[model samples]
Target: MKIVQISDTHLTAHGGRTQENFERVVDHVNNHLRPDLVVHSGDIVIIHPDDAADRAHARTLMAEFTAPVLVVPGNHDIGEPGAAPWAGIGVTDERVAAFESVWGTGHWRHDAGGWTVLGLNSELFGSGLGREAEQWAWIENTVADLPATARVIVFLHKPIWQVADEPTDHNLDIGESRARLLDLLGTVSLAAVGSGHLHCYRQTRRGETLEVWAPATAFVAGDGDTFAGPLHQLGIVEYDCADGTVRAGYRSVPGLDDVSATGVPEVIAAITALTDSPVG
Candidate 1:
């Protein structure tokens, strides 16, 4: 199965060149590599920006997808500190609700190409742990009931562990929210674990699981120092259900004067190359 993952397109009414770059990325995805599914890992807006309008715009963009587009909320998509109506309620709930209203609960389970795919909301304080616990229970029960040979894939908004300069948010601390799921998934012959939030990309292996983090489709966070490089990137990952393996490729759009100082298309290309491996 071919899946494209994009994240952190912080769009806003304050038009900028970055927005155009985002559109370019979108157009590229739709025109060339037609993915079976597109997974957006959040930060769809700049900051609330008239919630109604912002959300409408977000939905419209997502609707352009030729395949199913799955989304999860990001810290920016909700609101940052002192950011207005959204801030009043806490970013977690408001942002999550906004996403759910347009895209349905950012979490669920389904069958994809004979493989089980599970989406979990790891953005913290949104659905609350109790709700998460319930989802966890459901996932555990569901997986346990499935045959031992089932191939499973997991998706989330935040990387379970930090890579490079991206700090592990309190919510996604591998010791916390991700731990339960990881433990339950330990023996599941996981095809891959995909996530975003870290604008920088990285991939690793843990036993039989392949954890892949997709880069941002928007701008890259300035990492204070040692962060000088073009940042715009989008990932296309292909998974082989028959053997539980994933390979991904990426491309960088130019003319992004708003951000991305270095071209990162090679990053995407490199990740996509992993598909040749026997991950399952």
Candidate 2:
């Protein structure tokens, strides 16, 4: 089975280069590399979590893909939640509800080709919100209910790795959440844990589980990021799941630009936009 993973679209309502880029991705996935499934890891919107127009736009754009698409809420789609939430906006039940109103659910599970593919809301961890525990329980139950010998694949938005010794807002994993999640998945036939938010493509192995960071479909950073991959390339990840294992290959669209995130005006505006986002 082949799966295409796209992430960090950061699209606006009216339309911008980001939307154009995502559309290119959709066309590429449909025309060139037809995959069994498409998973948009997160960051479907520009910034505001409660931006109904952006959410609606994302839904419409995502529906263009021929294969079934499963989405996990990104910090941009729903507000961020951690020691240092982005723009002081944190994930809340209402923000989560807003995301679900368009995307149906913040998480989902699909049993496909001997693999149990699962999506989770990463922002919910350490959120201290009402739905945090609920998502945790759902995750535990979902994994527990899977077949004893079933291989599992997990996807979420923010990465759960401790990449730096000085964990800032960029590298924050919210304390023991990573260990807690890994421990729960330790019970399953874990194959790969896919994520985005880093805006670059990278794959690494932890013990036996593969960690894939899908490249941002939108743009790279011109001014550099506090904790970002050195490669400023933009693309997607194609995962080939067979032989009881998975191999990930980075794929870029034919004409997709390796533009900078700061060069995009829409993205900068989004970073400074205010909202009644039902978050901190």
Candidate 3:
């Protein structure tokens, strides 16, 4: 099975050059790559959490793809848990509902290509919401019920850890919940884990699980300072899965190398700075 992973499109209702960049990506995937499936890791829209128009526009753009697409929520699409509200827009039931209204459920399971692919809502990992508990139960049951020999792959919006054990507040990775999720995942026939939020490409192996991070179509985040080497490059990840193993590669889209510096920093700062209270 061929899977194309794209993330962090950050489309706005008005549409701009970023959207144009994404259009090129879609055209490339359709014309050249033509993968079996497309997985959008998250942040489908720019920061307009309360605007239904933003979600609608994003949905319209995603419809252009030929292959079936699956998505999980990002901080921008449904706001982050414990994140300060931008104009009273944080991760609320209403925001999640709005996202689902356009994109279907924030989490789900699909069986394809001889692998059971699970998509989780990374924003809800420690949100303390009722939905969070419900999702946890669902995940536990889903994994528990899978056959022992079944191949499994998981996708979410944030990386579980930057370093193996140490924790950092730089991104919305699972902090307190990491151990439990890792334990749960450890019991499965895990092939790989894929995510997108850092706006860079990274691939690592922890024991048997392959950790793959897909870069944003909208922009790249860090330069060499934040993430070394080609990891900081703007690109998407392509994975070929067969039997129980997965092989992955990064594909850079032309004309997007400088777009992040030119178009995204200010908005990123504004969204990152918003919080109801300071988080330690």
Off by over 4 Å in 3: 83-89, 163-170, 222-225, 261-280
TM-score of each: 0.74, 0.93, 0.89
List clash counts for every candidate, in order.
Answer: 11, 0, 2
- List CA RMSD, all candidates: 10.1, 2.2, 3.5
- lDDT for each candidate structure: 0.60, 0.84, 0.80
lDDT of 2 by residue, 129-180 (tens): 8788888899889878988979999999977776567646553343568899
User: 1 or 3, which is superior by TM-score?
Assistant: 3
The positional error of residue 48 in candidate 2, measured at the CA in angstroms, is 1.1
Most lDDT-accurate candidate? 2
Tens-digit lDDT track for model 3 on 1-280? 8899999888877677668878989998999899998999998887656668778988999999999999999988887775543355557788788888889998999888578889999888878888899889988998899999888889999887653344344444756677888888888998999999878788888889899888888877744224554477777899999867899899977667545544565455445655433323
Candidate 3: RMSD over Cα atoms? 3.5
The residue-by-residue lDDT of candidate 1 on 102-190, one tens digit each, is 77876777677667777766655234535456666777787787667678888776766544355432333233445666677775777
Residue 234 of model 1: what lDDT?
Answer: 42
